[model samples]
Target: MKYDDFMGEVQHRLELPDTGRAVRATRAVLQSLGERLQAGEAEDLAASLPMEVDYYLESADSGQRFDYDEFVGKVADRANVDRSDAAYYAKAVFGLVSELVSAGEIEQVRAQLPDDYEDLFALIDAEEVEE
Candidate 1:
């Protein structure tokens, strides 16, 4: 999707008041996800996303490893939002991403993460089942 469309979806999905919030949340989630994923997987995911969104994933340090709580904390810090809001943002942004990317890619991302991370992707899976 185009940048505008991508942000629009994020805004709608998150029920944010404006695109600015969506942008911050999206950047937060993508950057955190980039840090979690291996360099090659990050590169692959970035390649599949819009150019604007892809920038968030570029040059991520693949060596750093953290669990779900730490991931949420990092997102909150980077997004300058509260922890609760950060978790919601992660679900919204990642749900949109799961729709945009391939199933295999989603599985690849899930494999890198712990079981706690499954809750985020479950939002996507639930939506798919509803449709």
Candidate 2:
């Protein structure tokens, strides 16, 4: 999706007040996801995203191992939001990503992350069940 459309969807889905918050939350989730994936996997994922969003993946530090809590903490730190809010933002962004990206790619991401990360993708699972 185009950056504007992507952010608009994010803002709407999360019911955020403005684009700035959506952009921040998107960056937070993308950057955290980039850190979680291998460098090659991150690059592959970036290839499918908008340039603005892709920048976060490209700029991230890959090969860093972290669990779900740390993932949320990193998003919170980067987004400059509270930890609880970060979780909500991450889930919103990730849910959007799961819809936009290829299922195989999403599966690849799931493979790299720990089991706890599954909770963040719960929306994706719910969507599948509905389908």
Candidate 3:
């Protein structure tokens, strides 16, 4: 399939209830991740964040609401670790996710590996892991 076709498939998939929730969750994680980066923690993860901050605005724009802990719990399961470990990772992943999802800097880091690319999922989930 062409790139547009592939993108369309992805867009279509995003419409599912589960998939939509996941997107919102991912967005939430990314939002927090961006915040951390703004606070100078992106370097801790070895992430060379974009100079522009527009990419991370989605977290604010997205109206979807997630229980912070519950969002982290989901990412924890995806990472195959306990919530504590997940939260640790979440902080890092969410920070990057927040940046990449943004309009300005995402293309540069878009090709990053899923596991390491956005593993901050671990840390974001740490503070408020759901029951």
The candidate that achieves the highest TM-score relative to the unseen native structure: 2
- How does each model score on TM-score? 0.92, 0.95, 0.29
Model 3 misplacement above 4 A: 1-64, 98-131
TM accuracy, model 1: 0.92
Question: Which 10 residues in a row give candidate 2 its minimum summed lDDT?
Answer: 92-101
Query: Positional deviation of 1 in candidate 1, in angstroms?
Result: 0.8
Query: How does candidate 1 score on lDDT?
Result: 0.87
Model 2 regions more than 4 Å off: none
> Candidate 3's error at 102, in angstroms?
6.2
Candidate 1 residue lDDT tens string, 1-131: 89999999999988889999889889888988888888889988788789999888776676468888998998899889899989888988988888888989888888888898876786888888998
- Candidate 2 residue 70 C-alpha distance from true site, Å: 0.6
How many residue pairs in model 2 have overlapping backbones? 0
Of the candidates shown, which would achieve the greatest lDDT relative to the real structure?
2
Q: Give the TM-score of candidate 2.
A: 0.95
Sort order, lDDT high to low: 2, 1, 3
* Global local distance difference test of model 3: 0.40
Across residues 1-131, which tens digit of lDDT does each residue of candidate 2 receive?
Answer: 99999999999998999999899899999999898899988888788888998898878998789899999999999889999999988888988887778999989988888899988888888989998
Clash list (residue pairs), candidate 2: none
Comparison by lDDT, 2 against 3, better one: 2
In model 1, the Cα lDDT at residue 50 comes to 94
